[model samples]
Target: MAGNSDPLTPRAKIAVTAGKAVAAASRAAGRGSGSVIGGRVALKLDPDLLARLAQNLDVILVSATNGKTTTTRLIAEALGAAGPVVSNALGANMPAGITSALAGGSDAKYAVIEVDEKYLAGVARDTAPKCIALLNLSRDQLDRAAETRMLAENWREGLAGSKAVVIANADDPLVVWAASSSPNVIWVAAGQMWKDDAWSCPSCGGVMQRPGDDWFCGECGFRRPTPSWALSGDHVLDPHGSAWPIHLQLPGRANKANAASSAAVVAVFGVPPQVALERMYQVQAVAGRYDVVQFMQRDLRLLLAKNPAGWLETFSLIDPPPTPVILSVNARGADGTDTSWLWDVDYTRLTGHPIFVVGDRKLDLAVRLEVANQHFQVCENVDQAVQLAPPGRIEVIANYTAFQDLRRRVGN
Candidate 1:
């Protein structure tokens, strides 16, 4: 905000200032994250606070069950070439978090927001973003607290009435269905690593056919739209079949798929592919999503997952599992309270690798792993599990609260 000279109305400026003060006070008190309360204060003072702050900026709204944070960060980096990008990359995705972020970066010219699946429509209504990116629709039961099908419907309905152009993944059935109603949708065949959640067509309850990477409903004729942009090996493929090599700071085909979606997104603003791809390769981590935390002389790669779809992506990152892993789980509100999604994941892939289960829900995972005929050792704490890990680099795969707690423990 060194030279951000955009002026806000007097009342609106007052509201944003007050909100920031509240946020600082909340942080000083260590009451909680303070993201929610700060925005709550501002909105209570002026219900249209976010609208005022967003009046002059061109905003991009990113929503998805799994990759919202990472995708948002990538887009923010890509757009930073243009100007200061306001976003809640490290805060909450609800109304309050969005409010606080917008109020803080009030003078920014471009806003790249990460919105929770449930509050996407509400936030969009407040911000009136110029471009909307729907990554995929699914979440742990506690977030939106709605089933994936219903969430997709909500997104479709909300997007239909919005004026923003939509960039959607054509691979995920739910995403394709949800963004279908939007007037201007740019479909990208971003590969979906987890297909179990999208087994049936949301449109006609038809069994979809995955003859290859393409899927279609034989019964209702619903199918993945041909993507104008897609991934080809380690490069992004144009509709003309020209492949542009893209190397990212993040690993896995999933991140490449994310890059593909980000590519299409920035293109909506006439941002060149080189600018977007170059900016993306510099982003190594999004908050704690793919961070390496050091504790007790051991460096652990932190991978966070909240649901089965997330677990699928996480497991892919540890291909040919090297050493025993520190698997953590906690049934807290942030982690969705319900641990049933654990059973849905194909943990049998982890049959050969020894897993040191930790966290509040360790016993529950222990039982599930045993049922799958896998072997594991239960540790009392994350540190103890780390000590007992096989002599090599270890991965810390945890849910919401557990992941945060471990990161905090290591001074992250």
Candidate 2:
């Protein structure tokens, strides 16, 4: 018998024991048990276990400061149109979360994951995905990631020497520059998906000039090529604007970019444009990203505001029926400990008096609103805010953690 006190074999023994426990839990909980138990077990397991699972998967990893979750889901759904696809559908992006997702799938031709930028290198090293999609980078969670440049450096080092086919957003200067070193790179960008703020060239510190559906540095010759797949003209069509004829279920010009990026990956797998477009029109918005629901006998719309860029895009999409607004902020670690980032967002477009401010950081949010000279009422809780607002329709803008809490409180 093996010695119980063997120091060298402790890790192996621990892993074996954990594996047995997971198997037992699976038997007790049935087929869907893995969804509940796998995450916990995977988080506790040795790094080697996660590596083994990653090595076994035919993975496609997606990373970005924004649009990763929606784009990853869309890719998985499009791939699923052809065959069964596995993914961390619950928006879990860490190593253990992804490993648990793979472990839960009984049969899968593809495993698509929304990977966090900081974890991309380690996951890439272990998983060795068949493809990687790098979407646009923007400022987000400065307390955690510090800066976008740091994450870019980490991604470059992580993807070095990998045989994975890289699909990069050429519109983002950082992404374009990062892919320059990679031999296998496919650039995708929407030419007319114009943003006045995103006009800077990462190279040469010069302004990028968009001269007729193409971007080129005025100072440097670094020019963005025409995208393989592009979205042009008005994305929305019709007099009433009740229904957008195009594919996106999510609102705003940014959603169009996300849809285009998803289409690019699907196209790489030999899916025809028509089929991809049809499938895209069928896709629905994920939870907490422009999700709509019925609550309190009225239509309720929920949009998440995590960063300045995201909030700006959401504000642009807010059509005026003059619906009552419920804005919330939170100081949870996941939502960022500092609420200073709120100052960077453009809340001026939100023209309405007596907006309801909820969540643990309601006072901070109210203070920010005051600084912006916007009208708001600080509520003790989400329920009180919802109850106090008019019942015709409620439009909510909330941070990540507060969004969940408010959703639960509103029962939508």
Index of the highest-TM-score prediction: 1
Model 1, which residues run further than 4 Å from truth? Answer: 1-9, 142-144
Mind giving the per-residue lDDT tens digits that candidate 1 earns over 61-153? 999988888889899898887778888888488887888888777458889999888888788887888999988876576443898888898
TM-score, structure 1 vs. true: 0.95
Off by over 4 Å in 2: 1-37, 43-46, 191-221, 234-245
Backbone collisions counted per model: 0, 0
Kindly list the per-residue Cα lDDT of model 2 for residues 21-72, writing each as its tens digit. Answer: 6756876866433443555564576656555555545689899877788788
* Per-candidate RMSD, Å: 2.5, 6.8
- Clash pairs (backbone) in predicted model 2: none
lDDT of 2 at 272: 50
Per-model TM-score on C-alpha atoms:
0.95, 0.83
